[model samples]
Target chain A: MSMFPIIMWILMVVVAFVIYIPVAIKINKTGLKRLGATAHIFTCDPDKDPIK
Target chain B: MSIYLGVFIGYFAIIIISSIVGAKKVETMGDFTTGGNSMGLILGVGTSVATWLSVASVMGVPGNIYSRGVCAITGWIAGWFGGTALMPLIAYKIRRPAVPTRTFPEFIHARYDADKDVSPLQIVAAVIELAGYFVFSFIQVQGFGIVLNRITGLPFVTCCWLFMIILVFTCFGGFQSVARTDTVNAILILIGVIAGAITVVNVAGGMGAIVENFATTTAPAVTGGNPIPAGSLTSTWGVFGASAIMSTFLSNSLGASVAPHWVARFMAPKNAKTGALQMFWVVIFLIPIFICIVIIGMGGKALMPSLPEGVTSDYMFPQLIINYLNPVLGSLALVAICAAAVSTANSMLLHCSTSLIYDIVRNIKFSGGKKATVEDDAKTTKVLRITILVLGVLAVIGAIQQWSFLADGFTYVYGAFGSVFFAMVWLGLYVKKMNRPAAWVSLIVGFILYFYCVTQGAPFGLPTFIVSGGCSVISAIIVMLVTKAPPVECYEAYFSDDPSEATVAAMHRIRRDDV
Candidate 1:
């Protein structure tokens, strides 16, 4: 009944899409490379090639 | 009655089948504890979302809204969303290490005190996890009993005992079993909550009617209670006022982000990307589920002006199903509550047992100069199963007593977790100079302050977490500034993208099973 709950709920959805999705995408793209360079675990994406 | 029993048996069969399948995979300690750290995206999202829903989200949120009005959204829903949104960052860092830590305390041990066989810090971390997850498991069991009692017309104590069977069966097979069943539970929960919401909306005579009832109805939440103030249910602050709402928001959002179970979820995924992506998808998936939950809660208030004498608002969702919905739909909704309870209970029980066996008992054994091997891992896995059974019994006992409002029980533990682990986990990951002394001081300060505030009341009517968490962060920073930098091995696995061979070896030594 209060517009407040509805408004806040929408804001939550917006935060998830705008913030979480991009961060996840960035991590997926570059996280392994960053780790491999320093940790030397894998040069390529482990998701694509099984962890060996 | 027959329809309810038939659907319930069918649901149990599916869950038991999944558990049996999951049991086949538990060949080693790693497999049991972290699903061999190989969970794919769908399973990852399913388990995470299922665990996130819990009984609190399904039952307590609606109950809170029914009693407190729309303000319940500020703390539980919005705060949880905010917490989940931040998990990708934590997940990225946690899953990045080459040889990932199997448990959250193991990560803490590797990050802060890798040089030692078993640091006091590891023991302390494990203790906190043990206590937290034990209470968490108890809450889930209590939730399950409440719903089952309503459905079957069983005594409350009997209902609590009935849940232990499901809890043990789901948890005995370990993480993989829990994950598999959780996926099933998540799908059911989605369908059940949505169906219930649609019915609630319809029964309440459309959204406009519901809103009008909420805004204008002079109904008390309980029989003989004072009538609700006009427009209070429609106000932004509602009856809870701003301070309570803000307090709830802080504890739920900030506390949940670093909760041990969530941290372990990051470790269960195969890689950093999967870990991060799983959470992203979980956030998206939960949006609709939570929206429907809001409708169910607010709509319940609209339909039932006040509950009968001595009835708690915690019964709102179940009562709605029984009185308003037909048998088939009602059974489905009740099963969904079962799913929510089982999914979370199994996960929490797993965490509880692992913290006891892997973190505390094995840590002590290994520290005493016993090296870990594959055989030892098998032995440990057996011990973990036994621990689950033992803890399940204890939780059943605790759950027999209706402790508090289901959601409020979570807030207390979340407040403790947020205060104690917030600074230690966040700073330990990002801050290179975060040494053992800082970590120790921060944890103690946070724990003491949180409990003190809880018992003596927080200053300025602020949430206990804000006061305790603030002090903890300040203390950690101050100590870190003065203390010597942590050893290279302690910091490298988390901070250095390319840790040296020695650092890698040290990390491997931290979890000899990985080696």
Candidate 2:
């Protein structure tokens, strides 16, 4: 009678994201090490990065 | 009026809108170009593998089984098989500190930042690889056009343009959207293709009846010219060279693992190990011969016996699906086919866009000689999006020209780049003595020879690979020699034993005495 399936669908997506979060962090962590204009896609030299 | 065509467009609208809205967060250059280095293992592997295995591969593969026997089994298949099998073993070998900093060219540029000895090869590799990718990408879009035209009442060129617009929107989400959509698209293909295969087999009264039908079907008695003289399309070994060719073709696909988008698959997981494992499985599932797509092609040869001569063998599979499967089921399969074409072209469009903007266009110096760095993240995003559109347009224009063979269009060009950079990059990782100059010499030799061979092969259908590969390897070695390389440490020279361990001990005793 209750709308339980929608709750389950939301939970599944959340779980997938929870598992995926660390992997994304690792990729970003690696990207931070690269340096150049767009020669490299994700990287910016850490030493040069104002953000870092 | 075709049910499949309508369904395909319906799905296209949903996915494209989803892509643009979901990817709105990609406000930086990196996000637009590489999905901001944030794809999961499954999505990356799924999309990369799905894009690699396209409608042409799905249809063309089984046609090989029909027209030629085991020989249809060669190059990309064999290479991919070997590569997948070898993946886990070498995954770590490919994991480098600078990967995030690398585009395909950036990787080559760094890995082979050849000493004074090794520079030319890198440039050659870059140029050739880019060219190979460009042609393959163009054909992929064209393959979509063919499938769409066959299913719908629309003009082929119009279908191509419509699909091309879909392609841009899909890529508008950048790497993340592409991967997610492709993962869904691939599963749909697996299901649709399998359904199409079962229906075809059922209609034909199972495998035995189909085989029997195939055996009875003979060529209308040979015309006066005696086409393909002294050979039989009747056997697998004749024109197809099923075994040797199968191995060669599969071997060539190993070369794909190193392609720009494919290798980027390595960047999507917790680590290279996880990504490599995903790739390993993707290869097994996506083998040109394994699944329903290929089966559909064989089904077509049996079920559609009345298919006229010169009906473009590639169209046979789609024709069978449209005629035999239920309208809705057929529509699903058609969507899968269109999706396959669009996804691959999109991937190629992304790679070429990245290369042109990041490598070719941006690298060009001003008339007064000034360069700009990544000044605004938002601006960079806009530029890459524009680059994707520009490349998409160029490829669409090229697709309308109607090439004779999709497979033929890509191979020679890929081989040119593959011969030099493929060998050099692998060696650069392992062989310390190989200098940068050697890479350069090999590149010049490889590109010129490969270009010449491609022209000649156009008329004669000769191989560019063996010719270009042979020259590049020889030249690379010669340049290595001319550089007067130093003797690298071997088993004989582990280290200077600290000028004698005993002498060191004696010196320690004298120091103790002084103390």
For B138-167, candidate 1 gives per-residue lDDT tens digits of 889998898888888999889988899999
Top candidate on lDDT is 1
Candidate 1 local lDDT, residue B121: 84
Point out the worst 10-residue segment of candidate 2 chain B by lDDT.
Answer: B489-498
Q: What TM-score fits each model?
A: 0.95, 0.75
Give all candidates' CA lDDT scores. Answer: 0.86, 0.55
| Deviation (Å) of B171 in candidate 1 | 0.7
User: What is the per-residue lDDT of model 2 for residues B361-472, given as tens digits with 9 covering 90 to 100?
Assistant: 4433211223333564355556777878888887788888777455445444445545555545554445555556676776667667767765654223434555666667
Candidate 1 segments exceeding 4 Å error: A25-52
Question: Candidate 1, B469: how far from true, in Å?
Answer: 0.7
lDDT of 1 by residue, A1-52 (tens): 5677667666866776576555455554454553322221222244354233
**Separate DockQ for every predicted complex:** 0.32, 0.02
RMSD of 1: 3.2
